[model samples]
Target: MKLETLDALLAARAAKRAVALVTALDGHSEWVVEPGAPPSGLPADLLEAVRQALASDRSGVVEHDGRDWFVQAHNPPLRMLIVGAVHITQALAPMAAMAGYEVTVIDPRRGFAAAERFPGVRVDGDWPDEALERLVPDARTAVVTLTHDPKLDDPALHVALRSEAFYIGCLGSRRTHAARLDRLRNAGFDDADCARLHGPAGLDLGARSPAEIAVSVLAETVRALRRPEG
Candidate 1:
């Protein structure tokens, strides 16, 4: 790789942006594409290949016009921000980390957000809204609210609804979710925005225990990330 290209890749990584590096296997040409920016002068098929590589988070060689090209995907770690450091979060945080997410648990209640309770995970003591503002959930992020408290969960949802985060789930019963939707609608969120929330979160796996619920939530998150239309 050329020094300039290497520098550009490094900079993208530093900024937590998704970028791909494409190089001709015959050592003839190279291109760097960041999906957020319009890729100028790239053919439609080549751009589509880059999009596929970035979407699958996989790098491989592809053939076009009888010429081979290697596409390398450089994507930042997927992030999961859990609001409310309650029992569900206790199980959810570690499971999310094991699944390759950079997980962080947020709660203003310092006692619940203690680092010891979540050994290898990050615990934020700031209020839900404040913490989320600083973290800034992006397109590669998944945000879940495990705290049943409306005071905490509602504010976080307000911000999550406005973000590009791929998944947003909330822990509550169907009736509770209905009330929450009313609150969001009254607070100015449209039906389309409110629809993004996966309320009573997690797939219906007959989950009762914290760990089981965590598994369900994680599965739902994965589904949202991979099969968004469904």
Candidate 2:
């Protein structure tokens, strides 16, 4: 890799931006391309393949004009932000970490957000909205609210709705979710925006324990991210 190309990749990784490094199979030429940026002299078909590789977050070799090219996708680490710092978070945070997410638990109550309660995980003792604003959830992030309290969960939801986070899940019963939707509607979110939320979070596996519920929520989050059309 050229020093400049390597530097560009490092910079993109630091910024948590998705980019692709394309190299000729002959090992003679290479360039970095960020999605949505100009093609920078690459052929249209090669550019399209680079985009497809980046979108799939997979690195592979593609054939273009009888020449082979290797496309290496450089995507930021996946992130999960949990609001509430409650028991569900206890179960969910580590599971998310094991599933390759950088997890953070947010709660204004220092007692609830104590670092000891969540060793090896980030604990943010800031109000949900403020914490989210500072964290700036991105397309690679997932947000889940385990606190059943409206004062806390509601504010987090408002911020998550405005973010590009791939998934937003909230722990609540169906009736509670309905009421939450009404509140969001009252706050000016339309049905489409509200629809993005996975209320009563988790797949209906009839989970009864915090650990089981965490499994379902993570499964649903994975589904939402991998099968976006579904």
Candidate 3:
């Protein structure tokens, strides 16, 4: 345990990369190797401990006091795309951000879609389709529409249905959702594509205020993200 080895270990941890620590418990001076690096002819016990640590979900390996310990790093953050700058979105974006999501707010209206209103969020004032086209959505991304305006919400829904975005939702009443489905059908979206939308978007929590509605929507989004697809 020289200063250089300790520095390398700290550097690997800071970079969010996995590393293994080899120490002498009872053996004589030997070579030490980092995780994912070629291993030297270390003792059988140390080598076996390193192998087990790598095989497990843990990211780090420790050998001291005649024992080996492994520790796993935290998972990567999530990405959330909210397709509206309304009051509900204002509440939702911060909540999602606090919940460890990289929140991005998309609204075509420049007046409503500014950073001042939605502090740390990435605001995009372009049409949802065009904006999302440039920034492709993936399975790690959650997409939600809160405008309740067809002009903005419908196009985003269309794009999300075709993309691999994990969660797609739009806010509206049940009757309004039925009308939206009719329009989507008229626009050539079949039942399968339309089924991707979680309209009246949110859990059936009987939400009344924008903040409460945002919570329900966030809860449903979390469920959709974690649920295994059939």
Q: Which ten residues in a row have the lowest lDDT in candidate 3?
A: 68-77
Q: Estimated TM-score per prediction?
A: 0.86, 0.90, 0.69
Task: Report the Cα lDDT for residue 127, model 1.
Answer: 89
RMSD of 1: 2.9
Candidate 3 residue lDDT tens string, 125-230: 8999888787677766789988888999888888888888878888888999999999999999999888888888999998999999999999998888766362
User: Which candidate would rank higher by TM-score, 1 or 3?
Assistant: 1
Clashes of 3: 0
Per-residue error for 5 in candidate 1, Å, reads 7.7
Arrange candidates by lDDT, highest first: which order? Answer: 2, 1, 3
Those runs of model 3 whose alpha carbons end farther than 4 Å from true positions after fitting are: 1-76
Task: Point out where model 2 deviates above 4 Å.
Answer: 1-10, 36-41
Displacement of residue 201 (Cα, Å) in model 2 is: 0.4
Per-residue CA lDDT of model 1 for 122-162, tens digit only, reads 98989899999999999899999988999999999998998
What are the per-residue Cα lDDT tens digits for candidate 2 across 1-230?
A: 78999899999988888889989998678879886884668888778877888788889998877889998988888999999999888999999999999999999986998888899999999999999999999999999999999999999999999999999999999999999999999999999999999999999999989899999999999998889887
Ranking by TM-score: 2, 1, 3
